[model samples]
Target: MDTTMGASRRRGRLAAVATVVTAAAFTTALTGCGSVDKTLDCVQTADTIADSVTDLQQAVEDAAHDPGRADAALDSIETQLRRIGDKTDSTDVNQAVDDLDRAVGRVRTALRNGDRTPDVGPVTDAAGELTKVCTT
Candidate 1:
């Protein structure tokens, strides 16, 4: 009788350990899947923002010539970037958005000062850096 009780207790402990291990494995898998989704969203947002940067640069050139469209394209870019930042929950995205804002200021200055083109290198570099840091 004592031997049977000992065997039963051992089986119960083994079953309990198996259940805990299975639960832990499933929790890990779920957490990993969540991270994958977040990374995908970050990548998509980065690509969208990069494309918008191109549009904004072209729009700035047009605004320089027309003046009437001065803030229109820039405002659109700002709105899109805000949405991206909201989705990603990334401080890098926020910093890049602010950098782009400053770059827009530079473009406005260049336009008012009768310069043909604004210096956009800093803005490009900042965007690239932010995308790199945030996507990972």
Candidate 2:
């Protein structure tokens, strides 16, 4: 009877350990999925930002016809940047955001100073860097 009890107790303990291991594995898988989701969000936002940057370039090129379109493009880029920024706490990602933000600021400053054809090269460069970091 004592041997029987011992065997039953061992089986119970093994089941408990197995349950814990399974729960741990499930939790870990969930955490990994969450991380992948975040990365996809970031990459998608960066792609949108790239589009906005391209729009900004075109807007500047056609500034003689639509002087206000650049502002709209900048707004779009800023919104996307905020979305990506909110989704991450990575130093590299934040730095990329700051760089792009500064580039946008420079363009605005140029506009304020009566430079409608502000150079958008920096904006493009920063946006490319942002996309690269996001994919990584």
User: TM-scores across all candidates?
Assistant: 0.55, 0.75
Model 1 poorest 10 in a row by lDDT? 13-22
Tens digit of per-residue lDDT, candidate 1, span 1-136: 4745644554454344334434444444455677656655555555555555555555555654666454554565566567666776667666776776677667667767866555544545555654555444
Best by lDDT: 2
Model 2 C-alpha lDDT per residue in residues 1-136, reported as the tens digit of each score: 4745644554454344334434444444455677667766776677677668767877887888998999999999999988988889889999999999999999988987889788777787687677666656
Which residue runs of candidate 1 sit more than 4 Å off their true CA positions?
1-32, 61-70, 109-116
Runs of candidate 2 exceeding 4 Å displacement: 1-32
- Reference-based TM-score, model 2: 0.75
**lDDT (C-alpha, whole model) for all candidates:** 0.56, 0.75
What local lDDT does model 1 show for residue 41? 56
